[model samples]
Target: MGNIVKSLESSLATGNLQKMSETMDQFEKQFVNMEVQAEFMESAMAGSTSLSTPEGE
Candidate 1:
């Protein structure tokens, strides 16, 4: 809960995609395990990104 939020926030601040993904996985697991009702929201910008961009390109 709070931990995941902090972790994900730090990841976002540092632009750490790996950390973000891992934190999100944990977050999702917690919610699903608790049977928490979820509603996902998305905007058009959600689909307009690549997962990989080389470090020094």
Candidate 2:
């Protein structure tokens, strides 16, 4: 993510629209992957907690 932002800044400074667009595409893909992983982790944590609870409480 940091590398992508740095590349985007470099592209903007050099006025290279193509490189900027490619960097943005890469950032978008990385962001979506992080979101999916977060959701899966949250679901796994919830499942584990539910299974560890005492029967009457």
Candidate 2, 12: how far from true, in Å?
0.9
C-alpha lDDT of residue 49 in model 2: 94
RMSD of 1: 16.6
Q: In candidate 2, what are the lDDT values of residues 1-57, reduced to their tens digit?
A: 999989999999999999999999999999999999999999999999999998897
After superposition, which runs of candidate 1 have C-alpha atoms over 4 Å from their true positions?
Answer: 36-57
Instruction: Report each candidate's C-alpha RMSD, comma-separated, in the order given.
Output: 16.6, 0.7
| Winner by TM-score | 2
- Candidate 1 collision pairs: none
Which pairs, if any, clash in model 2? none
Off by over 4 Å in 2: none
What are the lDDT scores of the predictions, listed in order?
Answer: 0.77, 0.97
